[model samples]
Target: MRKSFIYALLVGIMVAWGLNVTALKILVDHFAPVTLTALRIFTAGVVVLLFLWGSGQLRKVSWNEAKQIGVAALFSVVAHHFFLSVGLTRTTAANAGLILGLVPLVTSLLAMMFLRHRLTVFRLLGIASGFCGVVFVVANGDGGLGHLSVGDVYVFLAVLAQGISFIMIKKATVEARVMTGWMLVFGSVWLFVLSLVLEPGGVSSLKDGTPSLWMIFLASAVVATALGHMFYNQAVQHLGPAESAVFINLNPLFSLLGAYWFLDETITLGQLVGFLFIVAGVVLGSGGLDDMSARFRRAKVAAGGRKVGM
Candidate 1:
C-alpha cells in the first residue's frame, strides 16, 4: 500500500511535467520569443519565491548556493529558453517535439561518457530505440534536414543545453546547499536584463496588455513553471530520476497534441509510428538490459560466495 501510494504520486507529478509542454506552446502563440520568455521566467520566479517565503525556505539559501543558482540559471533557463523560444518561432512544434525527444538520449550519453555511470544493456537499448524513433519522426515529417537555419540550430542548442543542465544540476546539488527557487530567481534576473537591452518595453507593455492573455500567462507561470517544478521535485523524491525520466516521454506527446488541437496543426501517421519507436526505445534502453545485468551480477556474487565458503 505504501509503495502503491508512492507510485501514484510519481505518476501524477510526471504527468504534470509532461503536460507543461502544452502550456509552453500556448505561451509562444501569445507573444514574441524572448519577450514571452522574459514574462514567463520572471513570473515563475516570483511565484516560486513566494512559495519559498511562505514555507520558510527562503532564508536558508547561502551565498555559495546563490552562485550555483546563477550557473544553473544561465544554462537551464536563460540559454535554454532563449534558444528554444526563438527556435519554436521557426520550427513547427511537431518537429520540435520530435527533436526534443533526443534530450534523454543526450543525457544518457553524457552520463556514460562523462559521469562514468554504468551503461547497462538496458540503458543502451532504450537510448538506441528512442533514437530510432526520433529518426522516424524526422523522416516521417515534411521538412528537409538542411540544418542551415538559425532557428533550427538554436532549437538543437536548447535541447543540448538542457542535457548539460541536467548534468550540471546533479553536480551542483551535490556540492551546494541550494534552494530550488534560487535558480528561477536568478534566471528571471538574467532574462530580465536581456529583455531590458534587447526587448525594451516588451515585458513592460505586457502589464497593460489584454486581460485574457495576461491571465493565460499567469496560469503558465503558476501552473507550468512553479507548480510543474514543485510536482516534479515530489516525483523525484518518490520515483528517482531514472524512472521519472520516462515521464518526459509524454512531454512531446502533449506538446504536439496541443499544437494539433489548439494551434490547428496536423499529426501525420508517420509521426505516430515515429513516436512508438522512440517511446519503445526509451522503455527498452531505460531498464530491460539493466535488469538482465543485475541478475547476472547477483548470480556471479552468489557463485563467488559459495567458492569462498568452501
Candidate 2:
C-alpha cells in the first residue's frame, strides 16, 4: 500500500476514535464501564473473526505467536480498556482526550528504548508541537487545569499500556488482522473475568439497555474498535510505531470536535490554534516535510539534467 493511503486511513481511524470518546461517555451512563468494555471488545473481536474466516485469512497461530498475541492483548486491550473505561467515569471527556494525546510521546520513548528507533530532531520537534497543541486545547477549554482527578491517572495509565502494546505490535510476526482479532478476543476474555470479580451485576445491566444504547454500543464496537484498530495496526506495520503514533496528535482535535457536536461543548479560539500546531506536528513528526523536500530536490536535479541535454 502507498504511504499516502496509509496516512489517510490513519486519519480516518483517528476520527472514529475521537468520536468514540463521546460514544463511550454516553454508553458508560447506562452500563458498567468494565462490563461495557468487555462486551464492546468481544463484539468487535467477533466481527473481525467473521471477516477473517470469510476471507480465508483465519488460521491458527503457533505457540510462540500465541504468546506474543497474549502479551499484546494484555497491554493493548485488557489494561488499556480497563483504565480508559474506569477513567471516563471519573473525569471529563476533554481531560481524557488531552491525556490520551500523550500516546505518541510515550510510544516514541518506548520505541527508542525497546526497538532502538532513533529520535530524530524532526521527531522531537513534532512531539513537542503536538503536545503543546493538546495542552493549548485542554488548558483553554471550559475549566482549564481544574485540579487533577484520579480519572486522569487512569487515563494516563491507559496511554502507557497502549504505547507498550504498539511496541509489541510492531515486533509481532503475525499478520495485522490476525493479531488484532486474537488480541481483542483474548483481551475481552480477561476483561470479562475482571468484570465478574469487580462488577458482578454489570452483565445483567445490559438487559435493560434500550435500542439507542445498543446502537451506540454496536457503533463503538464495530466502527471504532474493530475497524479503527485493524487499520491502525496495519499502519503500524507499514510506518513503524513512532511515525504512525505521531498521527495520534490529531486525536485531541477530533475529540474537541466530537465533544462539541455530541456533548454541546464549546470550542475555543485557542483550540483552533492548537489544531494548526497539531497538523504541523504530524507533518514534521512523521517526516512528511522531509519526504516533500527530498522529492522536490530529486525533481529539480532531473530538470537540470534535462536542460543540459537540450
Candidate 3:
C-alpha cells in the first residue's frame, strides 16, 4: 500500500479512537464501567474474529504465540480498558484524552528499556516535557502541584499497560489481525471475570438501556474498538512502533474536539498547554522529529542532484 494511504488510515483510526473516549464516558454514565468494558470488548472481539474467518485470515497460533497473546491481552485489553473505563467515569473525557497523549512517550521509554532503543538527550527532554504535561492535566487543570485526581491516576496506569503491550506486540510474529482478535478475546474473558466480581448487578443493568444507548455501544464496539485496533495493528506491522506511535499525537486533539462536540465539555487552558507539551514530547521522544529532519535532508539532496543534472 502507498504511504499516503497508510497515513490517512492512521489519521482515521486516531479520530475514531479519540471520539471513542467520549463514547466511553457516555456508556459509563449509564452502566457499570467494568461490565460495560467486558461487553464492549467481547462484542468487538467477536466482530474481529468473524471478519478474519470470513476473509480467510484466521489461523491457529503456536503455543508460544498463544502465551505472548495471553500476556499482551492482559496488559493491553484487560488492564488498559478496565482502567480507562473506570477513569472516564470520574474524569472528563477531555482530561482522559490529554493524559493518554503520554502513550507515545511511555512507549518510547519502554522501547529504550526493553528493546535497547537509544535514549538520546532529545528523548530525555521529551520524556520530561511529557510528564509535565500529564501533571497539568492530572492536577485538575489548575496546573498546580496539588493532589492528583484518582481518575487521572487510573488513566496513567492504562498508558503504562498499553506501552508494555506495544513491546509485546512488536515481538509477536503472528499476523496483526489474528493477534488483535485473540488478544481481544483473551482480554474479554479476563474483563468478564473482573466484572463478575466488581459489578455484581452490572450485566442486568444493561437490560434497561435505551435503544440509543445500544446504538452508541454497538458503534463503539464495532467501529472504534474492533476496526480501530485492526487498522492500528496493521499500521504497527507496516510502519514499526515508533512511526505508528507518532500518529497517536493526533489522538488527543481528536479526543478534545470530540469531547467538546459530543459531551459539551469545556477545554481548559491547562489542557491546551498540556496538549502542546505532549505533542512536542511525542515528536521528540518517538523520533518523529528525527524522521522529519532526515526526510527533509533527503529531499534537499534529491533536488540538488536534479539541478546539477540539468
Candidate 4:
C-alpha cells in the first residue's frame, strides 16, 4: 500500500481507539469493569470469528497454537483489559491514553530482550525519555509518580502485559486474524470468571445498563477491538511493525481531543509536557523520525539526479 494511504488509515484507526477510551470511561460509570471487559471481549470475538469465516480464513487451531493463544489471552486480553478498565475508573481517559502511548517503547524493550533485537543508543535514550515522561505523570504528588494511585499502577502494568503479549504472539504459529479471535474467546472466558467472582452482579449489570452504555459497548467492541485490530494487523503486514507503529504516537493527541470533546476533560500542563516527551520518545525509539528523514533525503537525491540528467 502507498505510505500516504497507510498513514491515513492508521490515523482513522487510532482515532477510533482514542474515542473508545472515552467511551470506556462512560461505560465504567454504568457497568462494573470486569463486566464491561467480558462483554466487549465476547462481542469482539464473535465479530472476528464471523469476519474470518466470511473471508474463508477460519480454521481450527492446532493444540500447540491453542496453547500459545491461551498464553497470549492471559497477557494481552485478560490482564490488559482487567487493569485498563479498572484504571479508567480511577484516572482520566486522557491520562490513560497518554500512559498507554508508552506501549511502543515497552514493546521495543521486550523485543530487544526476548527476540534478541539489537538496541541502538538512540533507542535506549528514547526509552529512557519515555520512562521519564511516565515518571512525570506517575510521580506528580497530586496523583503523579511520587504519589502513585492504584489506578496508575494498574494501567502501567496493563501496558507491560500488552507489551509482553506482543512478543509472545510473534512466536505463535497462528495467523494474526485467527489468533485475535481465539485470544478474545479465551480471554472473555477468564474475564467472565473474574466478573462472577469479583464484580457484584456480573453479567446482570447489562440488564440495568443505560442504552447509551450498550451503544458504547457495541462501538468499543465492534469499532475499536474488532475493526481496529484488523486494520492494524493489516497495516503491520504491509508496512512492517516499525512503520505501522509510527501512527501510535498520535494516539495521545487523538485521545486528548476525544476526551475533551466528549467528556469535557481538561488537559493539564504536565500532561501536555508528558505527551511531548512520550511522542518524541516513541519517534526516536521506533526510528520513525529517522525513517522519514532517510526517505526525504532519498527523494531529494532522486529529484537532483533527474534534474542533472535532464
Number of clashing residue pairs, candidate 1: 5
Error of 2 at 51 (Å): 0.3
Compared with the true structure, what per-residue lDDT tens digits does model 2 show for residues 181-292?
Answer: 9999999999999999999999998988999999999999999999888778779879875467667767877887787888886666876776677666665665555566
Q: Model 4 over residues 1-310: C-alpha lDDT tens digits?
A: 7879988999999999988888888998888789888889989999999999999999998999999999999999999999999998888888888899999989988988999877777788889889877776665425456567777778889999999999999988899989999899899999998999998786777788877777888999999999899889999999988888988998888888888999998877788888888888888887666577779999999999999999
Q: What TM-score does model 3 achieve against the real structure?
A: 0.92
Screening candidate 3 with a backbone cut-off below 3 angstroms (N, C-alpha, C), the clashing residue pairs are none
Model 3 lDDT tens row, 108-201:
8999999998878788989998988887676654334576677888998999999999889888887778988999989999999999999999
* Pairs that collide, model 4: 138-144, 138-145, 139-144, 139-145, 139-146, 140-144, 140-145
Per-model TM-score, in order, reads 0.83, 0.84, 0.92, 0.92
Clashes of each: 5, 0, 0, 7
User: Candidate 2: lDDT of 211?
Assistant: 96
User: Relative to the true structure, how large is the alpha-carbon lDDT of every model?
Assistant: 0.69, 0.83, 0.89, 0.87
Worst 10 residues of 2 by lDDT: 140-149
Worst 10 residues of 4 by lDDT: 137-146
- Angstrom error of the Cα, residue 275, model 3: value is 0.7
Question: Of the pair 1 and 2, which is ahead by TM-score?
Answer: 2
